[model samples]
Target: MKSQRFLKFYQSESEKYHGLRYGGLYGKLFKTLHHEALSGFLVQADNSEPILEIACGTGHTTGLLVKEGFDVIACDLTPGMMQRVSEQTGDQHEKVSFVRMDAFKLPFPDACVSTVVSTRFLHLFPADEQELIITEMYRVLKPGGVVLVDFDSWVHRWCWALPFALYNLLRYQRLAPYSIYNRIGRTITMASRVGFSDIKVDGIGGAQLLLPALISGSTALKVGRMHRRSVLRLIADQFMVCGKKY
Candidate 1:
């Protein structure tokens, strides 16, 4: 029932979701790291096969994939979200195939797709479910295929614990779920259990809680970029995990 509600909520929110999440300077910082991390992992994917992007809300990643000239399967549960992707990638409609399906039980054969991606999706669920989703991603990937998933970090949020609490308090958010995959160790363990080899993580989007809110956009951009490659990246707010099925 809650899952259905989430789907319905995103159904109504599809039109405004992009602006709501990626509007201001902080938003730009987040989006920049997201695009950078996803693109970096994508270039390493097997170009000969199609890419399956789960929960492709509002088509941000979908647009990027389309622009890169790969055949893409942009799967989401909400009709509105898929429609948004259609509108967003208007010029290359032929390259993107929209499918409305649940990510928990992907409707595809095993060892079929070359690349599987899920962004901003795992952090929404509990640890066990994350394992299930990762297992599913692995099952569908062809041998030597790559899977990349990016999510919000618990450690990063905890680093800004006071500000996050105050921010949520201001919005009347009294409760939230915690992600156990807060660092690379837990994430790597999950990948190994799912039979994924060559598992690695890339941290991105740091300094959100520590940086001054009034800092200029360029400065924030630098902070975000620096965290992505720096040795201190694991402490950043968001990170991407790339694993291979071989």
Candidate 2:
């Protein structure tokens, strides 16, 4: 039932309340990760060509893309999210357009878009459905255009993995779910199957490391400055998988 809804169906309640709440807290942390993922594509973007953002929740990323002079078509499965995006942008924002649509089955014509970007949407799907989603993304992108997918990493859960599991069980008691796969690896492999080339993954934040860093005082911050890469590698909560449609 969950697989069917995620793959072939669109649910507003899932996209609105469940999706947005999770995004609100995790979104800020992954902005840096998104920037890194988008770096090359944003530089290459013509700004005049159409860009599509699937599952564009509150339009935070869409708004940023619009401000950068891109013609963005932002779509989500939820009407409430689309309305929220419109309200967030105000009526005067001409560069942005909103549509309500499912990610797994996009409504856009083939090869019509210069790029497709969807952030923080993969974990919602089981593995096979995730592959289907990537296939859909690849199908719509123009040749040489890129697909950028940002998702939570397995490494991030290391901080409080057991506790997080317990908390989810308690808070979402009625949901009846579990982590179905190692989302990070699954996303990478799925993108590869969809013919995405030049795939890359990177760490986002030092959230976990910060906990221990707090204990060491000035020495920790100093150590953080020198060994930033090491800290980021260990405490990465976000991962971006990017590739070009070939």
Candidate 3:
């Protein structure tokens, strides 16, 4: 279930969320890097069974999965977001379904899903809650099933730390770490505890490190295009961790 805090935020933001997400060059860059990472996992997944996408905000990734020929259950905690997803995807694909649910308590049977994909959602909670969500995702995976989830990282925190701190202070009257090294480190440990093996972590959005130089629209597009390069992906601002249940 979506926390009251996040639920309220998304409810208010849903109307403009799609525009804000795709309107700017930075947003496009982030989306490109994110989809690249997601596609890499989906292509390797066993698509014989349905896949579950938790926190499927606006169905951007869900649409991709449907196009990839996987039956997808796209779930989110907010009805506003789910509605937007329906608007975006329409009724064109019969392989897709939308549901409202909590990430920590997914309503699925054990070992039932072939692949689980979540993006841009896990960083919302603290460490303990994140572990609970991870355990739940692991619980629903069939043997040999693959789980792909994204995490915010402190790898390039120095670049935007001050600005984010100021923004949070103005918005919430509190300073909080938006990205942290321990978040990803502890997530890997939690996945191990959940009995997920063959774990692999890949860095993404390294092009974000070039944000300082993106003064013009052209520069931003150039930097965004660099996201596909191998070396830049190694020092990314976020990461996607893939684990297989044995």
Candidate 4:
């Protein structure tokens, strides 16, 4: 199955994966952008109740939630990723529990969790699967509980589309690309249909729009850093959608 294949891939490439995605210079920049945009909402989360982090991916955001004083259940599909989370959390492991589970089928009961958060995971699936995953998150949340999720955005699709298309063509020998971009309108609509209300969305990581300069080793990093807080944030590479189940 595709799930098993991805699990093995993560297990084998865990180190390189995080290094490239969150540890490198560009990776750090991306993380800082994401953190700035999401921290406000996260800090305001109800810490008195238990939180579930689906597809936690080695506890990048899980560690943040734990440090913010939330009891976190960090769930991922790969044992290798969970092992990395154990190593990352260290003594804080007492406040964080790691579980291997599918996002489409969480093990928790309905209304058991006060908060559900996922990042950089949902956009990987097809539309139907994305809906199922969102519905699953909704199903396990308590009434009025919050669901925060991140997605790749189509706002600046023109910037990365060519590279992604070429990469897909060469790598898979097909035109199928790996990443999906969601429109803000569609994202909000999907959440409403999933029974969430008071929906809010924010854009982040506009540095990706300068991908050409970044690739050319130009002033893209400096420019991205300077303009990150400007109105250009509206055309960011990724978005976070927050909604409450009412």
Candidate 5:
């Protein structure tokens, strides 16, 4: 039921997604921060195997991965999103392969890819489901493989919590916000249970992330400084949880 709703939502809005998330000056600002946050994790992925990206909405990240010369298997449940990736890939077809996939049931063989990345996607599910996602990611990843996932910060969402929960409860009948949090302890435990090692969270996009685009240039710069202090983790807009499957 929940899966169907997500599929329908993405399928319907695939074409509009890029413009909404990566459009205006604000969009561009967030996009650059997003890339910077995810780039380090990308390099952590071994080049011996192709990088697997799950729930790659509209290929915004796909374009980045390919541009950096990594062969990627970008997977999304929605065909519309996959089509957009196809279009976004343009002449760089050989660098990426599109796969229509249900993350719970990745089509590839066991221990196939060296790295599995899914960002801005896992926080939608509850604690149990988030573990399920980590478990599934563990399955397809090679031993010592890297897995990087981003979560929406609970502190950052506090002001909007009511509307966020109300909207989800009303629209899809689900308000699974377990992954939206200020600390990485629980997430570390969640991933560790599934045989992940060296788990930690990295702060990206500060609380001022919602500010106007004109101010974002300096705000993005602040992310590096913000990440150094653990206290600021509460206000960060997103947290990147990175670990290795061992």
Candidate 6:
């Protein structure tokens, strides 16, 4: 039932999400947050290897990963999203391939990928389906392969208290049929049950206080500084969980 709901949501919103400016802004913001959250883990990664991005929307994160020299297989259930990815890639990305595949039943052979990464997509899954997807991630990864999952952590207001509250309220208006503030520890526990090791969380996307003030430059600097400090993890809006399959 939950999987069916997700499929419907993806099919309905895929085009709107990949084409609009607000969606694009959200996409870039998500990538920035993920880049901050995963910097430590990704830096430790062997860049010469290939990685799989489950539920990659419009290939935003895939583009960043590719820029860092990691080959990427970007997968999503949304055909339109995959089309947008292909448009962005434009026949030049030897390091990236976009595919349409279900996370619950990954099409890859077992132990085939060096890393499996996801961003902003887990909360879309109901509890059981989330577990199933985690299991699939584990099944597809080689021993010692890293898995990085990122999602909204409900504690987002901890950093920039005022702005986060306002932004979230506004977001609530936009991201209909979804609340976004799901349990982080429960998700972590699910990963543990799926046989993941070395589980740890990273903070992504601190507070954007000056958005109303129109201080883009200062806000960008603050975002970067907060990321460097890993300050948001102390009270992160999103949690980036890193673990190993073995």
For residues 1-246, could you state the per-residue lDDT of candidate 4 as single tens digits?
Answer: 878877887788677666767886666667766766567677647889868999888777877777677888889998877777765566787898777898878998888888999988988887778889999999999887899998887866666667767867886677764567888788889889989998877767654634645565345545554444556655777888889987
Give per-model TM-scores.
Answer: 0.90, 0.75, 0.84, 0.85, 0.85, 0.78
Clashing pairs in 6: none
> lDDT tens digits, residues 161-215, model 2?
7766786788667333434424556667778887988876555553554554457
Give the number of the best model, judged by lDDT.
Answer: 1
The 10-residue segment with the lowest total lDDT in model 1:
172-181
Compared with the true structure, the alpha-carbon lDDT of candidate 3 equals 0.75
The TM-score measured for candidate 3 stands at 0.84
Q: What lDDT does each candidate get?
A: 0.79, 0.64, 0.75, 0.77, 0.76, 0.70
Runs of candidate 3 exceeding 4 Å displacement: 87-91, 167-183, 206-234
Q: Name the 10 consecutive residues with the lowest summed lDDT in model 2.
A: 220-229
Q: Give the candidate order by descending TM-score.
A: 1, 4, 5, 3, 6, 2
For each candidate, how many residue pairs have backbone atoms clashing (under 3 Å)?
Answer: 0, 0, 1, 0, 0, 0
lDDT of 5 by residue, 92-124 (tens): 868888788788778888898898988778876
Say which prediction, candidate 3 or candidate 5, comes out ahead on TM-score: 5
Residue 102 of candidate 6: its Cα lDDT? 77
- Mind sharing the TM-score for model 5? 0.85
Question: Tens digit of lDDT per residue, candidate 1, span 1-246?
Answer: 657977877887888887766776677678777888888888888766779999988888888888777789989888887887766687897898888888889999999898998888888777788889899999999998999997677777778778767766664355343334366688888899999988778887765623643556676666677777677676888889999998
lDDT of 3 by residue, 1-246 (tens): 338878998888888887776556666667766776778777769877878999988877887787677888888998888777765555656777877888878988888887999987887777777788989998999888999988777655555678767967996578873333434566678889988888877666643544544676566545544543455534567778899998
Query: Per-residue alpha-carbon lDDT of model 6 for 91-210, expressed as tens digits?
Result: 547778778887888999999988999977887766776778888999998897999887666666444556655765785454233535546677678889999988887666544423
Which runs of model 2 end up more than 4 angstroms from their true locations?
1-29, 32-41, 87-92, 169-171, 174-186, 209-231
Q: Which residues of candidate 4, in runs, are more than 4 Å off?
A: 165-177, 208-231
Candidate number that wins on lDDT, 1 or 5: 1
**Which of the numbered candidates is closest to the native, going by highest TM-score?**
1
